[model samples]
Target: MDDLVRIHDILQHATPESLVILNEIFTSTTLADAIDLGGKILGRITAMGLVCVCVTFVDELASLNQATVSMVSTVDENDPAKRTFKVIRKPADGLAYAMVLARKYRLTHDQLKERIIP
Candidate 1:
């Protein structure tokens, strides 16, 4: 994890013309660990204003920097379990788990209307 942070520092001090490409830096790691590591690296890259492409599963990284734009691998709308393998530019709201639960349990607003009492 420190290596990830160190790379950020190196990139920060490097010439402005330098380009960095980090692929799947968070792979084979637990969710929490990946988030922690990704966050550190992203923080530095954003601060340095360096050009980078960091592929990661931590969706929160996308929103960490204004210069960072999210490109997500989307699932099928009809079947949330199916992956389309098509990456598209979109903001990660970090609500995918909630969405999946809602879909699985029919917990959408319309579905919950009758169960919810005002």
Candidate 2:
């Protein structure tokens, strides 16, 4: 059972969208379970000294519309070891909410998505 799942895991990681990768793997999981998995995955990455940034756009759905997001990174580009911001595609309102949420959480780039503009 484990071996079959492991093989499938490797192939799935080849997906371009991390969300799709996660969603597929976590199909039977609840939202809390998803969050737990994400935290563990991120914690492991962080422990390895890899910076994980969540770049969101206006909305995950809006991203299908070709929206673009503007972003800022804390690290100096000259520093090869630090993470950098590369713009993501999303809705404008979603991008704004992501920024606001990031600020509230005192975090940057943990997740990116659009929001309702109303």
Candidate 3:
């Protein structure tokens, strides 16, 4: 499809000095196919030592921990209406964003339990 063609075009002329930026690629395909194909393309780019900034909802891709890969996400501490994006040099925590934020605000289940018991 168009997505594939666009990606192919980008890859065809990509070089190590390239700074590729992609957003939700292969969305026209199934989730699994998108992840698989996208991962392969990204892997190829990574192998070429290209600097890429890809925005995707696929956790598999976001969790990529290669030496050439650095993951960053927008974080809104406890407010959902605003985007207080903090630039982090690592992957997001394994816990859900809400849960992590709750912990930050001392609002986690464990924190509540301690308050109730003590």
Candidate 4:
């Protein structure tokens, strides 16, 4: 995969002073695969002592190791569709990707059945 190739490059060349930023990666794969592979990449980055900023939808990634510091975007409780746009520095929890994203995008069960296009 393209991501794997890029990751290989990073692992081979990145130094401690480097700042690595990764967006949602391995998205074409399953949740378990995404977490497993992404977590390994994070592990390598931490081992190299690189100052990395990894933004991911995987909640489990929030607590990979001691070097990882997670920040999560919050949604309004009263209006779940409204993003507070406030990021809190904490480990993400109870966000099982599928259900969380469905709710976040306002794709309720009824709404999904009514949709024609993504």
On lDDT, the leading prediction is 4
Candidate order by decreasing lDDT: 4, 3, 1, 2
Clash number by candidate, in order: 0, 13, 0, 0
Q: Tell me, what's the RMSD of every candidate?
A: 9.0, 15.4, 8.6, 3.4
- Count steric clashes of candidate 1: 0
lDDT of 4 by residue, 1-118 (tens): 9999998998788876788989988899999999999999998888888998888888878899888898988887876656788989977875534666687777879777778556
After superposition, which runs of candidate 4 have C-alpha atoms over 4 Å from their true positions? Answer: 96-109, 112-118
Candidate 3 off by > 4 Å = 68-70, 93-118
Per-residue error for 21 in candidate 1, Å, reads: 1.2
lDDT of 3 by residue, 9-92 (tens): 998998878899999898788989987988888888888888889877676777654634556665565654344666567764
TM-scores, one per candidate: 0.56, 0.27, 0.67, 0.79
Q: Which portions of model 2 show Cα errors greater than 4 Å?
A: 1-24, 50-118
**C-alpha lDDT of all candidate models, in order:** 0.73, 0.38, 0.76, 0.83
TM-score result, candidate 1? 0.56
Q: Count steric clashes of candidate 3.
A: 0
Better of 3 and 4 by TM-score: 4
Residue 74, candidate 4: C-alpha displacement in angstroms: 1.1
Q: Which residue window of length 10 is worst by lDDT in model 1?
A: 92-101
After best superposition, candidate 4 residue 116: deviation in angstroms? Answer: 5.0
| Rank ordering of all candidates by TM-score, starting from the highest | 4, 3, 1, 2
